[model samples]
Target: MDKQLSPVELRHQIRSGEFSDQTSGLCPGYTQANLVILPKADAYDFLLFAQRNPKPCPILEVTDLGSKNLHTFASDVDIASDFPKYRVFKNGELVAEPTDVNDIWRDDLVSFLIGCSFSFEASLITAGIEVRHITAGTNVPMYNTNIPTKAAGKFHGNYVVSMRPIPQNQVVKAVTITERLPQVHGTPIQIDHPETIGITDINHPDYGDAVEIKDGEVPVFWACGVTPQAAIMASKPEFVITHAPGHMLVTDVKDVDLSDIL
Candidate 1:
């Protein structure tokens, strides 16, 4: 787990099963992605869902039907194995959490690469703001909120958000920095008040680990890419695969270049 490894190197390590942990602070300066794989039958609906709800499920690159190779985001990409961890669902039930999905690969599966908050974390750190989870060596805390997403086909559910506690004085700076990268869920959706967004228990998250919120800091919430998983649970799609919460795909694209996506 050398933090200095290049994106390609880190991905290769993941592909080889040498790295099977969450991808948070790794591959700094480069972009990271959230993954969603579905049978061709469900692809169109999910696409529509993402299009309608861009903040949480920003589309970075979607692979061709039945193909796992990616060209827009990374060269030499193997979609099935590039991500650190994968969650497989069957009829909306989580059936497996595998390091690689090659064994269960299907010719009709489509891969959707969604923008991730980790992509913008480096910029936040550069702005002199601390990303608590990264510094604490844990995954960012995520919560299921009462915020409803714009329904699209069978994908309609509440928005899932990742929380990062920002210092009181620097909250606006964090917002200004992230607002520039809309592709990766830009800006804080809810600030300082978790209960307003249906998050009753800040200490216990539905996904990932919780971190301390210092006296001078406030909990900031950003739309998370994992919202689709909640949709799966709500709609019960027969088969779908996603990156395990906090686990992500490290892409070759740089964070500074993400504005071009807008």
Candidate 2:
């Protein structure tokens, strides 16, 4: 329950079953990650898909097949136990939502650490921009969009986007600030018009809870990390594992390091 714990300490808490809460605001200055675990047979295609669609699927680190450690991102980290929660998919269906995946770990599984928007949200808050979802105490609204991704091998799906309502005058400033962190899903993909991106109702979303857009505010969209989960479901892989939405893996890398990568 210590919000100021280092990424290593947070991971240790998760490993010891002491903390299993969503990792949204925890470890504030560190980078939080989306995780994807796939069998080696499908890894090459997934990696290529990520490479082709960097906006939604930025690669942070990829562990060797059968290895539980992601040495580049955190020292002595165990992929199976570091995250607060995990989702197990079988042939595209979610079979389990478990706190730990140790029992399900496989020798041929490859772990991919993906960049998450949580890293960028901190920057948005620092710039005096009001993140409506956070202010309203609700998960960010996410919608399936008409935006198409560049397919690689068996992976292909429409883009998934996260929404935030910004005032008309501040939209440009928001875009400029977020654009600097391209590793964490950059600027607004669509502004003011939800229908243009295939979102039928601004009050309803495909994932996460809806938040109110005030009288002078316009709903803005950003490419989301969940886009890959949609792609994996569409591709119907025989088996896959991903971190539960909003429940991310914290890494030792600072958000400033990600800015440096841009």
Candidate 3:
């Protein structure tokens, strides 16, 4: 797929079964969202979970109960099918990795569109920082961390973070750029300390692919929206749907307007 496709165009491609790959480095300048869909019975708990854990779960849009439509982020969105990929979990175990969820749609489902670190990469690139995964043409490396999240109702788990190898000299610039976009996981949570966060093997991440930590580069970690999936795994929700790691929903909202909308 062309990296320059408009958000709606990309969604159309995804919806039509034409584009079913990770969304990183696509739709530059626009926002990409991490998805979480749960039954209405579990909506409030997840909502509370997100509120208690803002950094990893900054919410962009929450679809109305039972509705697949969105209001703030995109006009041509179908919560059931727009994302590049979807993971269905049953009792916390992954059951399927389908490109669309229309086959399993339920009226009682509630969708949460969480802010994604991918949304801020455009800024990082514009500032001359090399996003290693993008350069390597691979999914951003994400690791399960020892950093625990605040418990909210039945939703509770440790944080999941995405890693980027930032040049030592440009770490501050990368931080400064992302800090302005808190809705998209604002700043680095850990720098050059994977062991400090319970990650024994940075070379073998829990999600996505690991990239090289070059000579002058330090692995910078950012809170990731995949935190919910970790929570689902630990908390053992009966059923849940999520965008596969790195496979996100390209939203109509632009990264620049994120702060104002929130």
Candidate 4:
């Protein structure tokens, strides 16, 4: 469980069923992705959905229909098992949470690697800004907000966001640093205003653990990869697959070079 393990080595462990846990704190300097798999019938519309709602669905790579390999993320990535956990949705309801989807994967299945907030976390730390969830050893708190994303075809729903409590003074610095990584959810979408986004209770997050918001700290929200799942669920697509909350696909790309995909 070395946090510095290379992506290939870490992915091997995941494939072997040796590791099936949150990928957030691992491979700190590498880029991690949100997994989304859909059949070819739904792929085009979904891709259009992502393109319209780029912040929450910032796409890193989209695999061809029926293709099992994607070179954009890494040379040795297996969509079926590189992720520690996968959630299967049928008609929008999550039906199964599997460690690997090889048993059900089909040639018509298309996969997408969406940018995740974890990619910019290290930069925040280096900029003297604390990432609250990482400090608390828990997954970042996420919420489904009242904010709506632009609709594309059958894909239409509200945006989901991840929240991090920042000190009042360091908020601007945090924004400036994270804004540099546009491919991985750049900048705070809502700064210091939880109620503005319709989060009734910050302590009870819709996903992940809640961390304390210390004195003088304010809640900041960032566009999240979960936004797509929200749309998928609302649209009630016949079939869909995505990474379980908190778990993610580790990529061979380095964090410093994230802008290369931008």
- Name the top TM-score candidate: 2
lDDT of 1 by residue, 97-212 (tens): 99999999999999999887776787898889999998998878999999999999888999999999999999999999999889989888999889999999999999989999
Each prediction's whole-model lDDT (CA): 0.89, 0.89, 0.88, 0.87
Q: Where is the poorest 10-residue window by lDDT in model 1?
A: 253-262
Please identify model 4 stretches exceeding 4 Å from their true place.
none
Clashes of each: 1, 0, 0, 1
Model 3 segments more than 4 A misplaced: 2-4
Clashing pairs in 1: 91-238
Give lDDT tens digits, candidate 4, residues 174-260.
889988988888888999768998899999999988999999999989998888878888889888889987788888888898787
| TM-scores vs. true structure, each candidate | 0.92, 0.96, 0.91, 0.94
TM-score of 2: 0.96
Best by lDDT: 2
Name the better of 2 and 3 by TM-score.
2
* Runs with alpha carbons beyond 4 Å of true place in candidate 2: none
Q: Candidate 4: lDDT over CA atoms?
A: 0.87
